[model samples]
Target chain A: MGIYRSNRWLVRHVDVKVLRGQLVYIIGANGAGKTTTAKALLGLIPTDEGEIRRGPALKVGYVPQRLHINPTLPLTMRRLLRLTERYKNTEIDHAITAVGLQRLGNPFVSTLSGGEFQRLLLAQAMLSRPDLLLLDEPAQGVDAAGADKLHNIIDRIRIELGCGVLCISHDLQLAMDTGDDFLVLIPHEHDEMDST
Target chain B: MTLFDDFLIRSLIAGIGVALIAGPMGCFVVWRRLAYFGETIAHSALLGITVAVVFSFNFMLGVLISSIAVVVVMYYIDRSENLPTETLLGLLAHGGLAIGLVVLSFFPNMRMDLEALLFGDILAVSKTDLVVIWIGGGVVFASLLFLWRQLLTSTVSEDLAKVAGMRPDLTNLCFGLLMAIVIAGAVKIVGILLIVALLIIPAATARKFAISPEIMAALAGLIGVVGVIGGLGSSLYWDTPAGPSMVVTLMILFALSRVLKISYGTTEKSATRNK
Candidate 1:
């Protein structure tokens, strides 16, 4: 699949397939179309070339690169989960516990620490019991230790849910260590041809 | 019968109905930072009124048509161009207002009260105005209630909303149309200049104490009602302009809310420390 804007290609000639119970990480240099590939795969953006096909009855859960919650919007973590889909109290508790956030009491999403916020996002993704999970730079804004912890949680989630996982990251070495398979997106030879 | 015959009573009802719709819709506007967009649409109402007067069409229908047309045009421009939204809105807001004024100037024979149109004369609200306000307000209220969840999700994050099978584009289109309806319905009561103030101030005040979106919306509606009453009362007693009076009352409430927030924060901190 390829993505283009204004007669320029952002990503070209990319092929990726994610199977159940496997983790695939897409790693690249900054602006090498890592996020663009993920967005195109999820149908968030149109692909100018090639087609993307999903299995019948496929459900996708996505954790975006950056969640800029509006300050004026009053959304607690609990309410944020409900925004995606409704869940029972017990199910919400289970998901929260699964993500290892024990003392979470529905605090506003803005008030959470970086690590806690990533975990909260993980918990939200878990609520859907998705067939495929896509995470874009999930370790963004996190410390090294926090990133390790987040990756481990993601790995454990993939094992526990038995869902296909696709993650995008700029930290190639770090991603290679945790992922079962890796795809490196090299910048197009004529760099100026790429527009994100 | 005499009580029902009072124009003040009619104005009160009309103002309250408009407030009810404006309150909830305003929350979304504030949340999305669409105050300028709302202003642009409201400003276009002057042109709508001019067109209505020139062609002898229904005023509300003309306003709705013009505002929706503006919204559609804005949407396409936003999609096609890379221009900054603020610059575009600035051009449209002033451009629409200027053209409307110039057009109105050509028809000196028209028996139009420009002052009442620019700064609303709420006391002049007739019984038919009340009916229009209520019916339009009811439709807006019901649509908001139905689309509340999707709208809230879209405001939070459009990508996530799309992942959850909610169409942000469609939701926003509906939202823009609803805003047009409210502005068109409210132009007679608040006028174009002060319409955005009515949409924003009460929601801003409500944000201080609200713990949730629903509570914020409800509180905004209540605050709007208070502003209407206070403004109308002050206008009657002090011989002030009704629309400006209402906006002044809203500002006072916003100021009071700031004080309330500060005091409440201090008290809560102290109480927590004691505990």
Candidate 2:
């Protein structure tokens, strides 16, 4: 797929298929179209050339790179999860527990630490038991220990739920270490997929 | 004239109806940081009024057309050029107001009151206006309730909303449409200049005390209702302009809420420490 703006291609000739029970990483340097490719796959942005086909009854969850919770809007973690669709109390609690976040009692979203906030995003993403989970720089701002924990949770999700995972990574070594298959994105060039 | 001859009663009903719609829609405006956008649309309402007079059609229909037109034009202007939104809004807001006045000046025989149009003559509200306000309020209220989840989700994060299949684009359009409806219905009650204040002040004030989005919205509507009563009462006794008086009441409520938040905040801190 070629996603372009104003005669310049944001991402070109990208082909990725994520099957269930697999974890794939798209790793590249900055401005290398890693996030752009992810956005294209999620259908968030339009592509100029290729069509994206999804399996029947596909449920996708996305963890964005930056979530700016504006101070003007009053929101709790519980309320944030319910903003999209209503899940039962037990189910939300279970999702929160899975993400290893303590039960926060209606605290404003602005108060959470970087790691805690990432986990909150994970909890929200995992709530619907999505068939595919897309992570955009999931460990971008997280500390080392917190990143380890997050990866462990992600591994558990894949092994237990058999959901497909597609992550955008800037750290090539981390992608090599953890990802089942890796795609390297070079800016102004095509995608190169190499399965480890 | 079907129910009550008292213009005061009719004005009260119409003003309350405007407040109900403004309260919820205003929360959205505040949340999305669209206060100025709303003001721009409300300011363009003068052009809508001019159109109504020129075409000699239904006034509410004219207002809706102008408001929606401004929104569509803003969208295209935003996409076609890289100019900042603030500049575009300022250009349109004053541009619409000035052009409407200038055009109206061309026809000296038309019986349009500049003062009454800029600052509403709420006390002169007719029974038909009351009916329009209530019916419009019902439609806006119902649409808001129906789109509540999608609107709230999209406002929080458009990307997340899109992934969840909430269609943030469509929801955002619906939101803009609802704002136009409220602004159109509100023109008679608050006039063009003061309509945006009626929307934002109450919602901002309620934000000080609300713990959740729904509470904030509810309190905003409630505060608007109270502002309407206080303003209308002051206008009756003190002979103030009804629309500006209502805005003053809302600001006072906002100040009071800040004080309450400060005191209440300290108590909560102490209570949390005790826990």
Candidate 3:
């Protein structure tokens, strides 16, 4: 399936399948439709061509490149994790611990360092026990060591939950061993179509 | 009239009731940075006033209908076109106000106080106005409390809210309906021109001191109540326009909060982030 924004297609003739416990890495450059593809796959945005299907009652957890917590709204990390759904005290603590953010002390989400922010998002994603997990550049703004830890955590989540994982990133070196399959997006594919 | 005893007391009660509901709704307006959107809602309210005048009915019901119509038209425009929202809001705001004024001009013999209709004649509030404010304001207040979680979630992230099956669009539609209801009740308190200021200033001021959403909402209400009381008292003593006086009082409060924020040196951590 493919999606279009404006008059031209963003991504066309794209096909990928992810089974339970499988990791699919969608690698692409800027404007390569990685984010758009992920959004379309989740039904967040509509696609212009082809059909997309998902298992019924599929629970989804998404870690976007950015989680816009408007500065106007004061939100503690604990509150951010609990914003979408209510969780038990122990369950919240467990998710924070799983993401190695156990030292969180009710700091506003805006105060988090970049890596801390990404990890915090990961913690929230895991809270729902999702059946399909999508991460959009999950290792963004993270140091190499932190990136390694993030990969390991994702791999563990995949094994533990047996959820299909879709990782959208530009970095080829990101968790090389974890990805069961890879899809690369080319920039200016629209240009190729325009020329023809 | 005898139950309320004094006109001053009646206006005070009326103003406070509007403040009570405005505080929480104002926070959502601020958090979502819908100050202009609120302005549009208020401006469209002027058109609602015109409809009421033409129909010879209760102004509150008339305002409610017109505002709902404007909101539906806005939703249609937003979905049907890619026009920048602000541009459309500007068009609707001025268009509604101008059309209402022109319509009012056509009926010069209607025996209406146009100034009272524009800037608000809060001190002239009748018994029915108070009843409308309390009963309607109470319902909006309760509904806001019930839908707090869904509202906050949608404000934070529409996608996340959608994932949670919260239906962000429906949540927003509910919010607009509530805002419209409040605007209907507010027309007599602050009128159309100054109603948004009453909604926004208190909430913005309260944000300086609040550490959580619930606190912010509560503090905003308190600020609004204080503004209304102070504004009305000053208006009585100094003979200023009641609605504008209240708005000016709110501004002073907001300025004081800025000073308080600076003196406390709360650091730049919580500085307002542009959306």
Candidate 4:
């Protein structure tokens, strides 16, 4: 059962499930629990009284809305990639090149522009050859060309690895264009429910 | 000057070692706007120091225990969904400070001087203290180096870090450990209040000039070294407290950097208008 539930805070009585190998998109306004829900699923935040069960020891890859890599952090892509999974130097190079960041793996993360940094995050996510991929606003800072490339990479990875994916986005058109199953978070007013 | 030489050199070495660890760690504190968090953790050291003194334990031992306890507590509070961070830190900081004062008051028979621990006395550091500082500092340095990638990922973006298989909870525990060790190491040199300043101001100074994280860590270390040297020299010559002078040097650097940043900003604006 691909299911999780939480009502710990702003999200009240939330529960959902999807079959394995589904490409699901989660959409909601800012205050809705899209990010919070995602975090809960990832086990970043505890589910209060609920239980989150993983499917068959699946390796989950996530990309968050904002990664505030403090300028003081001593991080290089080569180092960042190593943290994610075991890969040969050539594989690391290939991944970097795949993300359009070839030969820049040694540079510190803080030096990259916004788009470059996001791509690096993407590459790190793919390092594990994960079974489930979760991305939050993968195109926020990406240029049009970069966004296209990111989408293509996501498609390629999914096809090659045969993994499930859950993507959250504020862009409805982009969500529509992706042509995946969608999960919408609509806040239900209790008073309206009482009237019903 | 033999006694002076022995104490000064030893203290300087210890101070630089502490600064090196604290500077980069403090950069994360400043960047995350966790100045209050640092102070809260530091204040908890007093209670730790008091417990150590009352029980006839070594002062460093007491500090280490109390510091670790405080960090563990803070970590728990930080992750608790029920309360906000500012509220949690505020309650713990003031409560710990008050408890420490009370504990020390209860130990009137204890002849140990509390002033040094509260305000720091680098000149009073012993050979044993120096050895502990080295071991502890080395551990912190090596740990940071080992976890450099994970730390950077978590600090910049916890979500991405987790996705990349870096556990933010563990990373935060490591962060707290570094803070606790630093408090224990520097409690004899910079005191509690000024210790946080050492961690923060140097990194802030480095930030003004550096554009990348790797360079920023290096620059922060350099700034810390320079600050400690100047502060130590001035305090020794002028018969002032080492902590205050060190803090002042850092403040002056911060002011200078701000001025330079403003000048550059105006120049850029003018250039853009002319173009």
A160 in model 3: Cα distance from truth in Å?
Answer: 3.9
Q: Write the per-residue lDDT of candidate 4 for residues A1-196, one digit (tens) a residue.
A: 0122443245545565544566778778876778887888887766654566688877888877787765544456666666645579877877787677875536656667788888887777777877888888888877888788877777776776687878877766766877467777755445234222
- Model 4 CA lDDT for position A156: 72
Highest TM-score, which number? 1
Backbone clash pairs for candidate 4 read A68-B156, A69-B156
TM-score of chain A of each: 0.93, 0.92, 0.91, 0.82
Give the DockQ (C-alpha) for candidate 1: 0.43
Cα shift from native, residue A69, model 3 (Å): 1.6
Query: B100-187 in candidate 1: lDDT tens per residue?
Result: 8899899989877878887787898877777888998988999998898899988987888888888999999999899989998888
Cα lDDT tens digits, model 4, B137-179, are 8998898888877776676677767766678779888888887
Runs in model 2 with CA error above 4 Å? A189-196, B1-3, B266-275
Chain B TM-score, all predictions listed: 0.94, 0.93, 0.94, 0.90
DockQ of each: 0.43, 0.43, 0.41, 0.23
The TM-scores, one per candidate, come to: 0.95, 0.93, 0.92, 0.77
Q: Model 1: what TM-score?
A: 0.95
> Which model, 1 or 4, shows the larger lDDT?
1
Q: Show pairs that collide, candidate 1.
A: none
Q: Write the per-residue lDDT of candidate 3 for residues B1-275, one digit (tens) a residue.
A: 38586889889999999998999999999989888877887887777888788888889888888778777878779888788999988988889888888888898777778788778999988888889889999999999988999999999888888777778888888898898888888889888888898898988998777777888899999999999998898898999999989999999999998888757665335433211
* lDDT agreement of model 3 with the native: 0.84
Ranked by TM-score from best down, the candidates are 1, 2, 3, 4
